[model samples]
Target: MCPRRARCFNTTGPCSPQHHYMLPPAQRLPEARELIEMDRYFVLHAPRQTGKTTPP
Candidate 1:
């Protein structure tokens, strides 16, 4: 691993220039999984496209 990256993972001292551009994932993965498990509804819509179907 890049030396700067190891340090930044812990949010310690300023990391070297190599670490500047990384953007973290928008939400931690575990929360996303929980939301998927609880999903109770969904919708599909079409305008110019002519049809729709939902699976059983």
Candidate 2:
């Protein structure tokens, strides 16, 4: 099997969940991965530039 490397930080806009560290404010709070894994519908709110689009 091929090994995988950590994703790099983005310099432009929002980042993928795998690159959460790039947007520290959007870290795994309220258990983002867990919530998503549940397959339930939900929503999140945050100010602009606070990683609102990155699942914070």
Candidate 3:
């Protein structure tokens, strides 16, 4: 197992709560799971620097 590290601010790439101070991605888009489970097509529209690229 890997040792837990202190969280810090992330300026590039994906942000993980375990290693970076960030809002939970799942909470940002609560409906994503339902939409995905339904197997429907959808688009995520957001400005740059937002967590839009993060995995659902």
Lowest summed lDDT window (length 10), candidate 1 = 47-56
Clashes of 1: 0
Better of 1 and 2 by lDDT: 2
How high is each candidate's TM-score?
0.20, 0.38, 0.54
Report the lDDT of model 2 for residue 30: 57
lDDT per residue as tens, model 3, 1-56: 22467776565676667776677656877997898899987788977766666542
Model 2 residue 56 lDDT score? 30
Displacement of the residue 20 alpha carbon in candidate 1, Å: 22
**Whole-model lDDT per candidate:** 0.38, 0.55, 0.69
Q: Quote the lDDT for 19 in model 1.
A: 51
Top model number, lDDT: 3
- Compared with the true structure, the alpha-carbon lDDT of candidate 3 equals 0.69
User: Which is the winner by lDDT between candidate 1 and candidate 3?
Assistant: 3
Instruction: For candidate 2, give the lDDT.
Output: 0.55
Runs in model 1 lying further than 4 Å from the true structure: 1-27, 40-56
- lDDT for 39 (candidate 1): 90
Ranking of all candidate structures by their TM-score, best first: 3, 2, 1
lDDT of 1 by residue, 1-56 (tens): 44643433323334334553333323423354455579944444555322233111
RMSD of each: 15.6, 8.2, 4.9
Once model 2 is optimally superposed onto the true structure by TM-score, how far is the C-alpha of residue 14 displaced, in angstroms?
3.9
